[model samples]
Target chain A: MNRLVLQAQILELTAIRYTPAGLPALDLVLKHESQVDEAGAHRKVALEIKAVAIGDVVRRVQALGLAGCSVFTGFLSAQKQGRGTVFHITGLES
Target chain B: MNRLVLQAQILELTAIRYTPAGLPALDLVLKHESQVDEAGAHRKVALEIKAVAIGDVVRRVQALGLAGCSVFTGFLSAQKQGRGTVFHITGLES
Candidate 1:
């Protein structure tokens, strides 16, 4: 199974604008400590994920009749060691 | 001279409980990448700092009559790139 991961803090879970095409969005305030972006920058950046991935994970969970609300607290991270980037997914928040 | 640095996101600057002793507290939601604490493990953790150091930074600013509200966005970091945690302070948020 393919998976994607992001490294950031769960700043706030406040609601975002309900887009004209999809459900409401979420505003995530995140930071970076040592990793550099495509711009070769060394700093923290805040990005927003308007639409949560409703792919494999979402589909599988929905099939099991499990609520997606629980995934809201999962912190994502993209870690780069000597070579290669690994997607690290944290365990579901209790 | 003494200095302290923290690495985390600005999460929410909402007003915190006004202790009968001080002004207000700022809640920070931060994360870690590869560094390990005293326990000797690899994982991420979130910590909070209340009652910001109103020391040299605050004292020096108060001398020039500059408002301290500006420093609210400064992100602190305790990075262990190779060894020895170095105190890194971000430039004032412009």
Candidate 2:
């Protein structure tokens, strides 16, 4: 089980494109900032993550127009050799 | 809100260390592999992530001896500029 739930603003967006399978896809860069409890202490945390939405989720994200924050639930996967990881968003809660 | 729950194997472990504040800390590289549902299809996912555990959590991770898989619950935070993101694990389930 691999899941990531995050509330982040759309920092940047790439044009909607199609996968080799012809599925609509949208790529995004997300900025997340919040205070988190860790090791019995609260720490300020910030992250910039690479994420993508495919199929139906792509259109919803495009409609949102990168204007606001949304909570995204997704799975993480490695992109390719030496490319780091990417978040694959499956659900969105605005 | 930002949270990530992932089941991964401990791929590599760093020597137990202490923070400047004297809190025990441990660094790890985690490898995650699984089949995930996304966009109405099952896709194979694999990731190698950098993670850290501090304070009490550090001891527990060290005792586990870098063997087997565990489910880790954490938050993502960016490292220094251009260094990518790190996972701050707060809870572990063996």
DockQ of every candidate structure: 0.02, 0.82
Candidate 1, residue B65: how far the Cα is off, in Å: 21
Distance from true location, Cα of A30 in model 1, Å: 32
User: Per-residue lDDT for B65 in model 1?
Assistant: 32
Off by over 4 Å in 1: A1-94, B14-39, B51-94
- Interface RMSDs of all predictions? 15.4, 1.0
lDDT of 1 by residue, B1-94 (tens): 0122333333323334443445333322332233422112244533322223222233332332312223322322323233112222223332
Candidate 1 lDDT by residue in tens digits, A1-94: 1112333344333334443444333333323233422112354433322212222233332322312323322322322323112222222232
**Candidate 1 global TM-score:** 0.20
Give the lowest summed-lDDT range of ten residues in model 2 chain A: A59-68
Q: Model 2, range A45-70, lDDT digits (tens) per residue? A: 98888889998898778877775588
- The superposed Cα distance between candidate 2 and the true structure at residue B40, in angstroms, equals 1.1
- For residue B10, model 2's alpha carbon misses the true position, in angstroms, by 0.5
Q: What is the lDDT of residue A28 in candidate 2?
A: 95
Q: Candidate 2: which stretches are off by over 4 Å?
A: none
The stretch of ten residues in a row with the least summed lDDT in candidate 1 chain B is B83-92
Candidate whose DockQ is highest: 2
